[model samples]
Target: MSTYLTILGFNSAIPTVKSAPTAQFLEMEERCFLIDCGEGTQVQLRKAKAKFSKINHIFISHLHGDHVFGLPGLISSFRLLGRETPLNVYGPKGIKAMMEAIFKYTETYQGFEVIFHELSSKNSEKIFEDNRVEVYTIPLDHRIYCNGYLFKEKPKERHLNMKEISKYPEIEICDYHNLKRGKDFILKDGYVLKNEVLTTAAEPPVSYAFCSDTRYLESIVPIIKNVDLLYHEATFLHDLKEMAEYTGHTTALEAAKIARKAKAKKLILGHFSNRYADYQVFLNEACEIFPETYLPQQLEPVKI
Candidate 1:
């Protein structure tokens, strides 16, 4: 079965006693992907009951402090926990330099190797791919060179038929593996069994996208279209539309609009501005346009 995505933190530039900045944890297939490690991300992850040791890849959307200020501590914690697995970090330029400076000044020694893959362009394209999933960079309009990430799981193999296997019990059980591989079964008598007779297609893999700290940019619609779950930044309410545009952020309604245009199955709104004491307005505003819209609070994990 496929795993669900979780939200770790969902506040804006200012971290309040009630909420923190942008940070998310995607739990899929026994692996964890940390997206935008904002300040106090470690604490939020612990609160969400996410295993930090399971995180092998970290994706940073931008160089803004609100997006990636917890790198030093997170890396240090890994070393302290005696982690030997290599960590692959994908982010925009300047991240490598920032990490290097942190390690050099703090004299922190890591038990694992840290690999940095920096993104340097605005074009929407694949940044990483493996047997498990593929990640794409979604260009956005921000004050800095920012990009979102889209994660799509690889398709599963076909299921096998146990009833058909019962008749061929005398035959090698290894042939069952072939059925799962979508191959036809052949008997010693030269008779062939079609794949459709012994197997069925498994469920299709799902996809999720994370878009934070960006303005109302419609160009990203194509990149995030039809995603199973989408988490976009909504730093202000509709009443603060001017503030959102001036600061290169987005309002709750604007985030919902993008989710609706992209035809995403679910929309999670976060990265709220500190000006709002309560998130009721944000929640009400977002759901008004998109009924599936949801507001993620700090350390509150919402299954996708």
Candidate 2:
């Protein structure tokens, strides 16, 4: 699979015995990323059997306790594990200071450098990029300066159509690489063979959007449009719309509306407030507007 997302924790505010907080482990294009290191994240990661060393990059949504309380502990664990690779942390402007102060007061020492890419721009911008994947920030409106993240895979190379290529004796094994790269092959007599004739179309790149704690903000529809999967906060029922707005959270209906407007293929609802006893209500409410909506399958790796 090119992309897999495991929900480490999805509870809001108070972490209960059954659930932790808002954190996720995303493996995209062979790159593992930790998103929003909330409390109990490390324990959840262990349960999920994730390779901690593979998580070289982390994306923090905001400074809320439920969103960032586990960051220092996770960093300490990395240090104890003797990790030498520099960790790149992408978050708001004050994240570095906050982490540094906590480490200093708590007497934590790091064996490796932690590169903090402090983000403050309200606009959506690319935060990380490599040969296989690209990540962007989705600025969110919450009580604090929060930002969601978008992970997109780079377009893959086309597959070599052996049956068609076998018809042309001039197409050698050495020409396979160029053909997959969409390059036409020129024969000795100057006759050209189109790459499309010898290669099948590549798998379409997929994208996953994480909309953390936010109000019903429709501005992000354009940014996450046509995403393969979307994980958005659905903290309250529509009956508590005023309270949801006051606390900077989204209702189940609102999250579905956002997913519908963005034309997302699937939607995962998370960050449920403890007030709700039955989680099925969330699924029922959201399914009304977006039938693809689903409650998070915690610890289960969801293919995007």
Candidate 3:
């Protein structure tokens, strides 16, 4: 099993010839999570060959059109395809009410159930928790009621060393499972076997943070520290720094600063302004401070 992240759309508010607004698809084990379904998100997913039917959970940062314009359409399509699995949506307040209005006016109905978990507070609270993962809301500064999301993998039990395990075939395989689970086993021969001697610790869990359309606020640094991967908005270049501040957005340099301060392992920058015909300037600006910075184009899949 693997945890991977894919970028479906990277533009903000507007759709350029080469880019579209904020959408990300994350694959964790057998489940998938969709973040910010902007306009044409389903189309982008089709191009990326991501299985839309596998998406049982969706997280929307805010009510902005660029962040959620495609949600209604995707839900409509799910009905057409006759999906029966229940869907869970996590978003800010008014999301549930907003979708209710749409369905009421349009007379749209789904074959499956849809559950919405509204997030209204500013504190970083646990919004979702399950056996495989946990998610929290990262309060963000934006024009509207906006926030970011953090996806953290749950700790897993250790795997036994198969070669070493084969030496004691006479031992019950059930006992070996106990040993791998950090339980000490007492062999029939009066030998005490420690769990550490037979198994190594599991690999550290990975995490991803998605900060879309937020201003340059360093307050979120502590919360996102040491994340395996971070996707922050870089909607403008240094030349338009003043405009960025006025519009509550960040430049490439500012995004890099947050990554550096947080000590993140890697930074992926996107949500570029419409003025930029080429994204090389944003790339060059961010890489100056954080060497692991990358500029992801539309439909580029970044392994987490």
Most lDDT-accurate candidate: 2
Q: Write the per-residue lDDT of candidate 2 for residues 60-86, one digit (tens) a residue.
A: 999999999999999999999999999
| Per-residue accuracy of model 1 over 1-304 as CA lDDT, tens digit each | 4666667777788777777777888876556899999888898888888877899999999999988898788999899989999999999988999899999999998889999999988798897788778889998888998999998887767887777767775446777677777888777887887888888887777888998878999999998999988889898888888988998999989999999999999998888777778888888998988999876755656555
lDDT computed for candidate 1: 0.85
Candidates ranked by TM-score: 2, 3, 1
Candidate 1, which segments miss by more than 4 Å at Cα? 169-172, 184-194
Backbone clashes in model 2, listed as residue pairs = none
Where does candidate 3 have its weakest 10-residue lDDT segment?
Answer: 162-171
Per-model TM-score, in order, reads 0.92, 0.97, 0.95
Q: What would the per-residue lDDT of candidate 3 be over residues 1-304, giving only the tens digit for each residue?
A: 5788899988888887778778999987556999999998999889989989999999999999989999998998998999999999999899999998998898889889999999889888888888879888889998888889999988777888766667765557777667756887677787876777777897778899999988898988998999999999999987788998899899899999999999999999999988888888998999998889998856767778
Candidate 1 structure, TM-score to reference: 0.92
Stretches off by above 4 angstroms in model 3 are none
Q: Lowest summed-lDDT stretch of 10 residues in model 1?
A: 295-304
What's every prediction's RMSD, in angstroms?
2.0, 1.3, 1.6
